[model samples]
Target: MKDKQAKWCPELGDFAGPKYRAIVAAMQRDIQSGALPPGTRLPTQRDLAWSLQVNLSTVTEAFREATRLRLITGEVGRGTYVLPGNDAVQLYAIDKGGNHDTIDLSTIVPARAFSSEDLRQSFATLLARDNLSDIMDYPTPDLMQRCRSAIGQFYQPRGFHPRQSDMFPCAGAQAALFAALQWIAKPDLPVLVEELTFPGMKIAARQMGLRLVPVAMDEKGILPADLDRAARASGARTLVISPILQNPTGATMDADRRAAIVALAEKLDLLVIEEDVYGGFTKEPPLSLQLAGRSILVGGLSKLVAPGPRFGFVIPMLEGNEARLPEQNFAIDELVHVTSWMAAPIMLELCCHWIESGEINRHMEWQRQEARTRQSLVRRKLGLPPLGRKPAAPHLWIGAGQDSPFAGLSGDQAAAKARAAGVEIVPASTFCAGRMLSDGIRLCATSPRDRADVTEACKRLRKAWS
Candidate 1:
């Protein structure tokens, strides 16, 4: 037993003097002396008890003390391991007196409270379906039909009566967006986007060899006057806008702005691509592509539902505008795999069940209420204005002033600081196109379950700002 203990630290001290403090001091000495390197797994509680000739409970207490010191991190089913040094030591250190668990504010996702047991049951039911073996087979029309039916049912309440022929399921909204861009915009042609927009659209445009033109935006969204000027000045005939919950800014287009933009698109002969990823969350989103005359509406289940669903519906413009799309589009060709599409029926059925049972609406209402409360707390704590409207989406946009402490830091710097403080955030630059610098950052308020987490996260953010 003494030999096994010596493997950790050959020079055994008088650990029997005071069980708790002695064990803690020994572990600290080993760490300082580099006997326990970063990422090194610590001995099991049982083994340590046997080696130290202490009871299992004493070993457990020692291990708990070490964990409190942030000398190690433990994952369930995985043994404890040492943590790396850095400011993360202060932020992640167990003795730091704050939550070390990461608060992911980067991705805009629905709150966990919004998820229902019915959804899980639906997934299980889908997995138990007859001919489940066939789902592993390659893509086929039967799979497409099933997915389309499920998708169509999902959007029926949104007044979109899409047929199986019209619906095309992709990996997610990102894939659908790429396909739409390829089909609509000519290579090297300037495509118009909101001054602040989804970062993925910019990346996709660059990869597709399309130039992105940032149209100016007002309180409502992309200003129609600026859209006209950009369209005429740049001769750009393609426009991509997130009519609902515009990324980074959280500005949704109202009726007047929507009508004006639609009119401009018609006059400019532009192909309008409305990416309404959060359409399901809203009571009534803007007019669908079918109403826009010559537009493409991209809807997905990733936002309102679980992202793992990987199901999206692309409703092309009315019959006559099919020629406007590219002849050989990969989005139109590479249909969703049978297995991926199989997940659709389960999601749709779950959504339907939740909707009928009033659980979905209730859950959404609770999320909206909780989100608003959290957003209000963030506003009060950070001394920032409100970023979300009454519906209260998952994320909020924070404007950091030039003289602000965070102003000197870059986006990555801000993210690193926030992460070091155990709160993750997406910088404003993540949403901008070109080399434009933004004086803001997007904060996602979806994770915190109580006001305490929100307050602590805000306090950490204030420190990061300083």
Candidate 2:
């Protein structure tokens, strides 16, 4: 059999000696060099061990290492296979990477340490009472009051003087947006937004059958004049904005821009829906554009707090509108409300403790420093120009160069390249409601867990671009 064989597999022979790391390196090289295409079935443990003349235990360990690196996936009653698309695999690995793992610039959360121990203890205390019956009995005025107080305290310094009656609790930001769209805008009406904006809004508008109108913007933000023209042309009655720390772009509206937008909205009699998912991360309180009193501010704990909290509060600028707001406006009714409301008390208590202890502010400051540091690294190491001169909020936007790898490609294509390069980026196309296109990509620096990881990821991105 040995005399008749053509040759031993180079990978098996190259991965010689006792250590399993050689096997991992050999497999990685093969994958990177395209010797093994995606979806290629890997050798079975026993077969690979026999072929390599190694113990089955060595093969098992090697397979585990590959899985850890996200180079291979296994199935029950089936063998492992290479994951489809290098970019997809890279994103999956980066998303699942633990705290001690390398930095991933693709995620959108601050890197500050969060302590949920106190909150967990509070939850346990509440659970000990076992008063589940009362908590489950639908939201009452008392519960509303508690929720309002908790949410109000956070907004008070930000110029949002909200009353208990003005507040409404919902499942999360998406639900609040859905309800707001349904309540405020008529079907088929154009909803104005930044040319580059949040993807969630685009998804929600499409699902609700609302037409989106993208307005032109400058360094400050959406041009007030452009907004006016679009509103007039489309008969748009509502404007959706992220005045502070605008997603994908990370451009905060300066005081002048805010006043100009508010002025335009007042002139047009437009209702504003302010999505404040990144609200809590700002150093100073954001100036609310809810000045028209026709605006609705959507705040949530997902970004500042853990994503699974599933808690959000909506504060309507217009008084007496809550009574007129449709019950369907509270989108949580579709899903079992118990899941969100049951955890409400605990969330409320945590918010209280975080605010009182000043931990929230301290954390925000630390995150700001981290974000600034990462942004600087991206500019210097990635050889990319700054998107703007303002203080970036956890994200940096880079315009693709003419000779850039992402040039001439559509936003999705650029995103694919980024994924393949082992980094995740938000394409600028999703932000544009119309046919407008931008040669920009948004890089998130907040979720990488540490500075070194961010630097390494940036280096990979620079190499990919080159």
Candidate 3:
């Protein structure tokens, strides 16, 4: 018998996927069509199960998924109701028109280190070069060699030293990560990652049909015991780690922490993908996991330099072991060829020029000073502690402290509050890989071009919370 009070029953015919997903689709459609308006009490799981002739578990799963999508809310005693603002499907939407009024602390980007004239001059120099036509063509081996040489010089002091044959040019860190995933882990295989990790890694994993197993992390980075447990439980053979200035959360692994992780990885025979894109910000970072034979390092220029150039490197730091290069190189090469053909020659050359001419160094030095200033300003505004290492990280993690306005609120709720105040922030939910919900949001200090904007954003954020 059906429960008389259960009013909304979706027609799941139009959706072609799994039954639960179809139910969600039907619900979304009905909500949008105004057939099921906001505050309309949804059918009880059992009643819906009975009406739709699907299992109770199916309806339960559908409800869970709907809740995750923020389509509906469930009261303690009452049934589920459509969320008031269900029209906005995406939580994080990029406004391309670039609203000046809205202070965006969401994306981590370096502030302007060079003027427009400087950029125009660089392009002019490129155009005037006799080899301009060569750069326009597909990337040649010699071009990659020159880039590798330049990368070696820039990254040598930062604890990265790779043989010329061990390096591959990538369009950006994302591409490098994707290529690394493809090369190391097979599709559908479990890859261990930080519980709260880079959002791009989540996207790339989903795109490539790879399963991500979340490992527990602390203020210092991933816990070795948790990593061991997660790896053993999931039988994951690969791990993607950011040892220095982890994304979303500014968790940098110390020397002892790194050693523990490396030892655990060795024991488990796990292939570690170490991402050190933000490593340059630290004056002296801990030794990279790449120095260990089992690790592959992915480094790039996007964070320290401008995001426009799009140049990154994939190097297998095997410690003088070329035995594994042939197979690994083939896998990476084929993956890159299939996806992007090759890194854009012009972009690579531009970055290489910046590196060789010491312009990139100058840009980094300026970025460091700018980041420290912005960080100090934001911290002061929010009454937060100093974050990261000496040079200062571009981003900082904000948790719901006892006195904070975000207190007693989840990361997403806090972010929503900040967004309401005309400041944008990335919630912890955006970075989560597993079911565990994180408590705080990420604030990128260098996201706003001007220091005053960062200050204003923090002021608004604090006031809104207060």
Candidate 4:
């Protein structure tokens, strides 16, 4: 006498970790998505296991984990109910005091920069291939070879060339990071990172039981002296670095600094992990840490080609040791097994076609141009000076300088003003590593759908804060 079909049962898509943990995580994702709102009743363990076609013990363990997170309640002689998470609810608030229209700049995503272009030709060409069936299957060694070759070719002109034998396609940047963590970190080991870095890396580090030690940085980027001190002090063998157009703070290291950091890495015997996701957007990309010595360099198409696919690659560098690739391949195999080894065949073919036909280069140019134009618009319309800016970088900052008029305003206060203006800006705390240097906000230079939207948002920003 109940609607079984309508009840919450997780669609556990190719996820890593234990089955029980996956269940808890999936339920949390659903709860945060508002699919299972507060006070909603969940099916009993037996009912859920029967409905989901899983073992009873799995459901019981899942329910126990969910209860531990305070995401659900188990009542005696009654049923389970979703718990309240007001903080989580605030994340997806669309209606701002009764308005549905809002320009979101809080998310770090590439804009649809290229206009007058369509994917019809891409798909048509892909569909016309004779080996279309093989493309959809899990990544075989042959397809991986082609993908790695394509990735290498794309990066060759940019100064960060990678060997195809060492490269393998991953789901995304985070996937590569997870594999790196598993290979380098043990329980309770310390890992060094930029004071302000990608938040996803921080989350992954915590999940892997690695402690993130924040290294100091200067205007040009991570200070070599501080890195040495931290590396020696914490005895951290692994360091995660983003050299070009760093997130939250748009710092780009010069050649001298890159060389210095490399020297320190060799001296300290550090295992370097370079995240060069924004490499193509920069005019003079730095040499990848892989070139220096033993390291891991992550490359992805999501930032350049399009944001739709979870397409990325990880290259394990050991300076042609011949013995290291096998171990690295083993780690990659584990990741692939857990994450479902292949990207969609269509995505793989599209990337290859773009690389072979040289169309991806044109797309990259357009994205860079679009990003610069947006940055200029933000400066002119909002009358805000950009801090830590680089050419064609997709994100920029508006900091409160010591003697500036806006010094009294906190990042949260500034963000609230932008929100009232129907725009959402990321707060400073979102990127804080160990601490914050100043109160500021990061604005996505290429997130809005169009220039007019950003212009209007800037106008509202000026009216509210300036």
Candidate 5:
């Protein structure tokens, strides 16, 4: 089946004007009548041309027709394949069961912000590369270097600078965090995280058999003083913090606070794991703690680029560059053990294409504007409290107070109430870490597909909570 020279001959039939059309018609008949089964290889253009006494172009045209009919798939390096379907194996099937009425305000992803044209164009450019085959193999060190170099350029203008050697590609921000945690977290020694954090961190800490030491915070991220206090008391040597547009609670630490926190981490000899997942949406990112030598930066293209790609990269400070604290250091071995060092090839390639082409910046701008517009709509409709200064950020964190609408209810009950009212929101409980949890809910502004949907959801929220 690998060699096309074995020559598959479907006898050319009469009643067709064009030889190519006749060839296509014969192919369909043979396939339908069980003369040729699914996965049966058709002859190579040249071989088929010789056998049928037809020109190569004719055979090529016929193959294209067959492929267009979904009877085959043409790979670049690999020969055309009879796409196994009908009686053969189906590669995939669409999941048609999903509720359409609920306006989801929990899942934070772009709503109709990306264009199919742009995605297709990026792939087309990727396909044009002569070294496309090289990408199919385990991503080579050189390819990773390309990603690092590209990543460095992307973040450099935003004030994040990591030596290319320090940067490594990962599957997503979650992967990077999980990998680094496996290296540092011990059973008794809990790792420090924002009291209200992205749920992934808690899940990872649990799976890795490490406890979480919650650091108290306010409107601005983890309070520098509180972070130091928790780290010192718990003897936690590492900190996973999201200073830029933090999740569940959209808290951003201002420049002075960020510097203070980084200085405190340095003072306490703590390994600061800076999660910069939401930094790309802003034009002027405050100085990242990742700038410090002891910081492990976890960043990715999920928020800026499409989430399906799941492209992420980790930058572990170099050996000499990190603080000399032995407890704070992470090794490459732990990362390899955590992720098995596998990154998605196709998505990574497409991401590299966008970064190199400078399309990512343009796309990020659109997303920023889109997110802002949605937030404005919700703000106007609900008269909600200021989530933060950045309208470009996705979620709004609201507290459950006694005087507040859902007075006696917990976050889960409030969330259920919101769902019954025709919209869905994430309970604050989902993001809570340890006893220092928030009695709140996170309304992600970018979940609904359109502005009307977002507005409708907000109206429902007001009806439920007001």
Candidate 6:
């Protein structure tokens, strides 16, 4: 009975489209219904083909589809088995220091750069405006254009110059990313991403029912060769990348790497969605992927100023390009409409005021210095080496591979241990896009407001792994 149960096969009842797709659909349905539980071994492709009276190639295609959706995994000695992806949870939604007992370092938030009095003054400034009632009303096209113009002025000095015609303000960077996905990605299709990425992207992609194909990466983010291979293999046209101050690993691609990546994207006809939320931290950040015609640039003040205002913008580099498609323009218009509709006019007004009044710049300068200070404290507490010439990121990565101290432990186990020690840090698995496991964890130095809290948290983390 156990042997028979291991060789599970899906019933191909009346379905639409191709028979291969029907097989995949049946598998999904059965999995959802709990008929095929996680870890259940699936029948061989040949056996399933014979059982369903279908061709071997058809079963192969079905297995390929299932694998791409992260539904099953094939082992060398062992057969293919169902994955527990359907039961996976989103890790990006943080409660934000909800429990005082737990020093939460899991969420990557900028340190508090302003006090309550400063906030009150900002509100006072906004309240003192003569056009208060007009600001409360819905934002008109001209008003929004004014907001974009202010944003453009801000980005111009930061090495990213966007065409006024190509920009759209969003509620936040996450909102901009989702809007970009809606504009470019087709549902149920493959979207290429770095093997380890922002947990929010993973959550958004899963919610949209898109398969994320993980491209291999190095110390400088995603490799161009691996990206090319993954694009060809998966036939994915969209690639989401964080070139500077990448989360978890803190890898920032240099000028040469960025050029190589943009060139590869052009060669593959790939649509690059560049997430540059952390670019403001760099003193001399390299040129952005916005230079490419097939790229969408996303930046936010959440990581720079604060998460409260929820302000960001998206720009599609299609203005005055001869290769621009009519449908692409339509998509951009749809994106602008959707983002504008979803974003709060009041919040946009407040953030725009901050941007124009230079309040955001003060916050950015404070965050830049404070982040480096906290990073040094964490390093000293953890007995880690100095970053030296390498630029410092807001987060630090601790690897637990064979050569490391925490060698036998997985990312989940490390995180669990940290929690038991009354500290919160995110594991590598939370950022992983595919089934590949990583025995590493990420600690956000800037998440906590005080350097002493970061110090104590690092101490607890050391004890947790000791």
Best by TM-score: 6
- The per-model lDDT (C-alpha) reads 0.64, 0.64, 0.75, 0.70, 0.70, 0.76
- Candidate 5 at residue 48, lDDT? 83
Model 1, 146-245: lDDT tens per residue?
A: 5667666666666766556766766668777876776655666677888667766766765676666667776578989988887787777778888777
Task: TM-score winner between 1 and 4, please give it.
Answer: 4
Candidate 2 per-residue C-alpha lDDT over 1-466 given as tens digits, one digit per residue, 9 for 90 to 100: 0011112233655556655778888878876776764546677888878887888998899888776565665544445665322232233345454443334565566665665775576466556765545554666656556666767776665666676666777776767776667665555566788877676776676566565676777667788888988778777777888877787776677778888888887788777788888766664454443464667778776666556655676666765444433233344232224223434554554454555556556666666677777788777777666545566577777665575445566455676666676666765544544433344677777777677777888777666655
Clashing pairs in 3: none
**lDDT minimum window of 10 residues, candidate 2:** 1-10
User: Can you give the lDDT of residue 304 in candidate 6?
Assistant: 82
State the weakest 10-residue window (summed lDDT) of model 6: 320-329
Model 3, position 229, has a per-residue lDDT of 84
Worst window of 10 by summed lDDT in candidate 5: 87-96
lDDT of 5 by residue, 280-304 (tens): 8885553443345676778887777
What is the TM-score (0 to 1) of candidate 4?
A: 0.74
Between prediction 2 and prediction 4, which has the larger lDDT?
A: 4
**Which 10-residue span in candidate 3 carries the lowest summed lDDT?**
83-92
Off by over 4 Å in 6: 1-70, 73-89, 92-98, 284-291, 320-329, 403-405
- On residues 1-466, what C-alpha lDDT tens digit does candidate 4 reach at each position? 1211237777886567888888888898887887875556788889989977889999999987776555665444346666444232243454434755788776667778544445777777888978879875776767767887888788778666666667767777777777666666676577788876676675676577665666777667799998988888777778888888887777788888888988888788777788878877876654454346567787687766676767777776767432422233254345455332746666776778888788888888888888888888887776556533556677777775544334567776788887877888876645544434335778786777888888887777777776
In order of appearance, the predictions have TM-scores of 0.67, 0.68, 0.80, 0.74, 0.74, 0.83
Clash totals for all models, in order? 1, 2, 0, 0, 0, 0
TM-score of predicted structure 3: 0.80
By the lDDT metric, which is better: model 3 or model 6?
A: 6
Compute the lDDT for candidate 2: 0.64
Candidate 2: segments with Cα more than 4 A from true spot:
1-104, 115-137, 283-290, 320-353, 356-359, 384-389, 402-413
On residues 1-466, what C-alpha lDDT tens digit does candidate 6 reach at each position? 0321455666676678899999999999887886875556788889999988999999999998887787875544446766545322544455555767788888788998789999898788878978778766667786688778878877866666677878788889989988887775556667888878887688788778777877777788898888888788777778888888888788888778888887887678777788888888886543443345777788788888888888888888755442542224244667777676667777887888887888778888888888888888887777777677776778888877765445678666888898888888887767767544344788889887688888788888777877
Kindly report which residue stretches of model 4 are placed more than 4 angstroms away from their true locations once superposed: 1-99, 114-117, 289-291, 320-342, 385-389, 402-405
RMSD of each: 18.2, 16.0, 6.9, 12.6, 21.8, 5.6
